[model samples]
Target: MATTQSFFRIQTDANLQSMQVGSIMRKVKSRAWKKQRYFRLQDDCATIWYKSKKAGNAHSTCKLRWLWKPPLISISDVEAVREGHQSEVLLSIADEFPPDRCFTLVFRGRRGNLDLVAESAEEAQSWVKGMRKLIENLENMNERERLDQWISDWFKKADKNGDGRMNFKEVQDLLKMMNVDMNEHHALRLFTMADKSQSGTLEDDEFVLFYKMLTQREEVLRIFQDYSSDGQTLSCRDLEEFLREGQLKQDHVQQHSMELIEQYEPSDTAKMRQAMTIDGFQMYLLSPEGSIFNPAMLEQHQDMSQPLSHYFISSSHNTYLMGDQIRGHSSVEAYIRALKRGCRCVEVDCWDGPNGEPIVYHGHTFTSKILFKDVVTVVGNYSFKTSQYPVILSIENHCSVEQQRTMAQHLTRILGDKLLRNALEGKGSDLPSPEDLKGKILLKGKKIGGLERSLDGVVEDSLAAEVSDEDDAAEIEEENLHNDSIRRKPKKSKQGLSKELSDCVVYCKSVHFNSFKHSRIHSKFYEISSFAESKAKKHMKDAGAEFVHHNARQLTRIYPNGIRTDSSNFNPQEMWSAGCQIVALNFQTAGMEMDLNDGLFTQNGCCGYVLKPAFMRSVEKRFDPEHPEIRDGYRPVTLTIKVISGQQLPKVNLKEGSIVDPLVRVEIHGVPKDQARQETRHIDNNGFNPMWHETLTFTIHVPELALVRFVVEDYDKTTKNDFIGQYTLPFSCLQQGYRHIHLLSKDGTSIPPSSLFVHIRIKEGT
Candidate 1:
């Protein structure tokens, strides 16, 4: 009971207390599909337990709430609580309920958002307010406290019979769900030890005790003992040695050692004695400070005053599509997701819609449409939430002059001062820095004869112009090739540009890419060009150095080829190697290519802008990634990563006979010379504590640009391997020494209690 009590111990407020009473909320999936779901806050305050079926009405309560199994929304899993009619899903049911009566629970990763409507607005506010407070409280919890809460939640979930106790069979089932494939005899032995009452069914404290024993990390104990002289407590000197040798903390050895002792040492006596016990050592190892990523690099540490073209901006192509290119739904949710993830650049394909408004969707396709104003509103709301850097709205305009004027009006009205209408007062021919244009949105599209206007600041909407390139050139061609809905049509000529929309283009004016020499001679700093994947790759191979020089002055965007009907992403690393600033990828897709993009922008505060190397940024000097040795600062690095072990590896398949056979794959993504991968042998029938202790080595020719990806896969000789978890970071962002690489789920969200212990050694090669 005490063990379980610890899990439910949070300072309960009025909102949480009221929520415990439960409410009858209508779960809205679509306009036609709305059902009453009984929602109640679990006693732990960490979960919102709801039934899958309807609750009939508000008066009738769930008889046995705890026993109402599965599909409960864990608070930690929720990314944000979107209130009002904030999403397209909620907007569909706008007619049935008032705005304040509806809210959406946006989950992390690729999980579909849960849209709910309450009987009254007050009920909705209570749930939203309560859920938000819970999330905030969860963020402030220590690692140990979070683990305790998790244990309690699992106890509630695994107690299938609702007896507040787990029998041997139930405990076995819990183990399997926890990603543990343990031997029956061993499990029985531990279960017997924890049953101090000698009862066949174990209670709360007993379950907690059993969990501690089961998850005892022997490998960590071995490492701790290796550093501790007494095999118990690490003295100040001993701790300093560990920091210096293991963590590679050379300068602040004594200072850092004492700081860590005070931070992680739970015992007051141990802290006073300047010693660290086993528990404290474990706590330190699991903290974010002990992560593989360099702690100093976590914040916006890089120089942000550099020109926008000097950094690799995190750009997304077709930000409105949540699914395949042709028939995917176009919703405001896609815009929200991309902006919330620190995407600095997003593409908005606009066309004429009902009521003389502009709509965003994939042109010439069966894709649905949402109002352009809705997309702008979402972008403005979430633009600076994750990052304060400038957000470029790559406008793919296919609208009439009236609708185009409406698009510009929506941009200025919805985004307000955030929209950069006029250029910065002090800026020259060179593009402004991310710092200079912080919290602003820039338009990237075709304009009528550029930024030429009369002295009175009057612009004519009658001025018609043309741009040589269509932003969705490939997609439109493919749409024409296979337009079953419409007859096969000729290649559409370039559409006219609206002077009103063109006036909004402060920076990132889209233009056709002819050649590197022509761009260098004719292109202005604000004029940007887009290239298809094939053309970009050809340019990268042939005139790589020249492309690097061109990008140093002007912005170059690379998008996936039109033939990719499945909405797949191209490898952005090649374009990045040539210093292309905006290499847009399909943000909805996930793979090694997306992994590389995630890795590169993970640092520099994850501000969606990573500054290029000095060589690439320099005007006189250019770095041809094709010939790495010719670079000015060509300090090659030899990286050695010793894969010690994996902790709590998730089960790829939860079938009775299936246990994960896990393997680790370490890939280096950079210049051709630095790109390579090495993997370790797979372990059989173990999803828990699979030890490899194998080493993978690579010589990165350009460590500054290289990204290292650590992947764990469920190996299958019979079929293709299943992805388990992965973590990626820039090669230079690696913290030298023993560190834990916390794994991320497929859609780049943290999967807690899943990590790999590895020792790293990076040395200058040649």
Candidate 2:
């Protein structure tokens, strides 16, 4: 068990501290679906519980106003709190409820947003400010303190009687809720030991001790003993040896050791003597520095001053769809989600609508439609929230000149200074860098003529040029996607562009791809080509070197083919290898492909742009991803990982008495030669403290482009393995030595206390 005390502390505002007395507010799902519900923050300050009408009628209120239920929202799960009619759901009721009284709780993960309308604006303000404060508090918590808070919240949940204490039966129920199926006899023995009062129940402090006893990692203790000089703590020299030998810290080893000891060692005596206790060592192992991903890559460390073509941009296709392309709902919430996830390029399929307005949706489909103005409004507001880099609005214009003028007006009015209206003056053929275009929005669509025409001048000043058949191609792709037997030639001619909309295309002029040589000979630097995934794959295979050289000079975007109606994604690495800058995926879909995309952009301050590798950026290199050995600065590495054990893996099934048989899978995604997969044997009938003790090795040839994914799944012989949690990162960001892989839910939110412990070793020249 942990040392005799708990280390949990929460600093709360005076208003939140007095929140035991809750308030009543209207919970709204849609314009017609609004109900009054009582909401209250739990005493732990980590959960917000609201009572349903049925529960309110049948159950008596507890000390708090809300009923004890499973529908409570954790404070940490809230991604953002937006005021006014921010969401499409909220904006629909703009006439019913005033903007000042409406607010939305934008939850992380796949959970739907909670729209609420307060009786007064003051009530809405209080909740928004209060919820933000609790989120801030959770964000500021250290690892230990966060664990302590988690344990506390569990304790509150397990105390079914609301008596401030949990009996043995209640503790058993708590164990199941925490995703641990432990041996009953073993659990009782530990429970008896923790109940020092011999009262057969655990108070808050006793529960903390019990948690420690149940979670004590003998594997970690063994490592600590191996490095400890006197069996109690590790001296500075001992730590230095561990850092140099095991962690691959070649320079300033002694300094790194001392800094870790001074920062994590809780005991003043230990800090003064330059020693690390077991607790301190474990704490250090769980900190960000000891995380599986390298902390250095978490900042803006890459050079961003290069041309726009010299980087990979995180992009989203069909940015307004929340589901399948044929019949999905179109909402502004999709744009918010993409932008918040550091997406720099988003596609909008604009078609003519009523009132001279342009609407966004897949054409010739039953998918719902949303106003283009609303989409632009959200983009203007949230574009720079996650990344200050430029956002490319990939426009698929199927609108006439009249509605196109309205679309142009909305762009200039709603986006204002954020939109790049005027073309860069006298910049030759080279496009600008992301660094130079920060906080700007660039339209990616047809330009009627050259970009020299003034944006504020007359709409008739620009020359009209026939737009490409890209929109026609889109219709043909959809037709082929649904009916493979029906093959029709794409309509050759399309409507010309409106000069008003054409002026907004400062850069990223969409052009049809004929050939690489044709582009090099005739295309300007600002011009770009959009390719369907199948077409891009053909070029990557047929002319890999030429594709790389072509991308080294101008921007290329690869989007998913129309056949993926389920909104699935192609492996982005395939396009990245060809040096394609914008490889658009369905951001609403969560899968391995998006995981790798997130990994690449997560570094470099998560600014949506990552610099292309040196070999891919050089026109002289003429690199081929299919032949990595020929690339410059190709250094392979050997990654060795010991699948030591798991700590409290989340159960995939919530069915009563259901337990997980967890297995760990490690995968490497990169150039063809470097891709590999290895997994550990499943541990049966245990989600808590399952030890694998297996080792998996991989040889990553192109380390710069490689991504390592660690996954946990529940084994089931009768069906497909159910996913539990996973963490993925760039292979170069993998840190050597003992570390913890903090797992994430399928929707990419941290699943606290669900993690894997492993010892990593990396050596050069694999």
Question: Each candidate: what lDDT?
Answer: 0.84, 0.84
Which sections of candidate 1 miss by over 4 Å?
Answer: 1-4, 52-69, 452-472, 475-495
Model 2 Cα lDDT, one tens digit per residue, 613-657: 888888776888899888667788898999999988877788977
Per-residue lDDT, model 1, residue 424, is 78
Highest TM-score among the candidates is held by which one? 1
Give per-model TM-scores.
0.94, 0.93
lDDT, residue 181, candidate 1? 77
Question: Model 2: clashing residue pairs?
Answer: none
Question: For candidate 1, lDDT tens digit of each residue in 472-525?
Answer: 456465665565554233344345666667788877777777788788788888
Model 1, residue 251: C-alpha shift (Å): 1.2
